[model samples]
Target: MKDFLSLSIANLLNEYIFVYDFLDSYDLKLKDDELSKSFREFFDSLDEDKLEEKGLSIDLLKEQFVNFMNAMTADADTIEELESITIVGGVNKYGEPENVELTIRKGEVICIVGPTGSGKSRLLADIEWLAQKDTPTRRQILINGKVPDKKRRFSIDHKMVAQLSQNMNFVMDLTVEEFVRMHAESRLIENADEKVSAIIDEANKLAGEQFQANTPVTSLSGGQSRALMIADTAILSRSPIILIDEIENAGIDRKKALELLVKEEKIVLMATHDPILALMGDRRLVIKNGGISKIIEVSEEERQHLPYLQALDEKLVSLRNQIRNGEILNE
Candidate 1:
């Protein structure tokens, strides 16, 4: 059991660092390989001798580990569960996905934004398949009261969730309408024509001025491509939870497109670098090094504060450069 806890901690640490490294590159533009390596080497150096010197009893450690794991299990309450998303208390000395607690209410637009290498994608994946048994790694993921057995497909109770990633490709043979209709037919009921019509209308509205229903998706611009992908995901999947990655591609007015999606009140978990999209979210989670560093509530206060702060910082930097280049001087 002591060995088990130690091993679990090591895994959690690795995941944390892995997530951080990935986000660092994407969000902060930092190459942190050397720092990550040092951390890993430091962790690897810990041994049983070090454990004994710390005065931690193997029996006590094992008991705590079991208790921690149990807290992450179904027995924990909702508040207890959401608390797990905060990295400080939920994660143990050894790296394990224990005590993960978060309940994303229905229809809230939640944005997961962090620098590259920060675990935005991983966090999105975790939320999509929270607390499942057979996840690639044995991280704790719980849905409602049960551990989602990895073999089971539809485990989480939150309505069917749809994920629209940057890389999901549309096959050339299928026209845009055909692709969306395929999903509409399956998810909608016997009286789906009205819903289908509404979906079409909504999709068209969201597609911006340039899109036409019959347009072969292949001919669409990059922005149009992104809009169509979003339209397909929004209309086709009946699931209330939608996960999108990097919606702010070069071409599209992704911010407006997302605002339309968010208006529907679906539980949206999106990862992007765009500050505009991040600001639009009801809640913004900052992920780094595989752990959540800060969760900013985009309330009236934050809405007013963050943009101003960022702009001020940018202005200061610009001024500093100008002064260094003799663009301005104390006279």
Candidate 2:
């Protein structure tokens, strides 16, 4: 009866929540009414006699929440561990086939857009299996149209899918030069040192003059961190596919950063709620209730409709550069 009740509750939760897979993929524990009950019970259990007259402060609560989130992600050491990647329309146990099927080509950017609770992260996870592959619920992952052997070195093959989460962090002790160099050192190419130096130079070019390669990551603003992460991932990666989640939240010159990624010719698959990021992709796949509701090529007409001011700004940049370079300005 206990087993049956547990299964019943799980089914009920699945039926209502819609995107239970997304929550589970991100390790976000869903809170139902039972969770409220549990919180209440725990609060009640605290000995009133031992309790201080003062209630819990907001600071204390915030600290506790931060601690909780960190603890949850403690085992997530590398970027790969955080990826909950999945392919579209993967086979599952329910005997029901997935309706959404997407074949992402190499050296292209595919943006995924959907409403809230649309299982975007799950889709990311399915395509890029990360640190938590040890569990029973594994991604039905495939690479280059073949099922990769799990027993083999997954990290090497996984280089194909570089996932950038919303929140990026770095070791404050390492300078930007040192940080990028360390990642570059791991490559197997001949003259690796020279290649590393070139990568750093390229990354710096994209990052711009204001942000120094020697600057500590701790001093960086949210926007700067995002830029650095992009540089690091873009330069160090030999990956064919890059997965980004809610990149618009980084509060940076997102268009410039995205332009750099696109220019690199890497196959980018971003999960974005922002239409601006959505427009950056060659194609947009809209997911709903764990299925693809719409898969459309971003036509030129659609591209023109997206905030025209940004395009105007790019045009102005070209005009100014042409004037300075003394080419088209005279014509």
What lDDT does model 2 reach? 0.57
lDDT of 2 by residue, 1-331 (tens): 1221223334534343422433353333544644433222333444454434445433443345344334333322443322222343642334345555456655567888887767666666555553233322333554444555453235453455777886667755787677767676544345656755665555455442346767776776665677677766775677756788776433356666677676766677888766667777889887766556678898988888677856765576667667767876643
TM-score of each: 0.55, 0.57
Residue 80 in model 1: lDDT: 27
Q: Which ranges in model 2 have alpha carbons more than 4 Å from their true place?
A: 1-88, 91-97, 130-141, 151-153, 156-160, 249-252, 307-331
Looking at model 1, residue 243 earns an lDDT score of 83
Candidate 2 positional error at 182, Å: 1.5
Q: Write the per-residue lDDT of candidate 1 for residues 10-50, one digit (tens) a residue.
A: 35445433333333432322234434343223334445465
Off by over 4 Å in 1: 1-100, 132-160, 249-255, 305-331
lDDT agreement of model 1 with the native: 0.55
The candidate that wins on TM-score is 2
Candidate 1, RMSD to the unseen true structure:
20.8
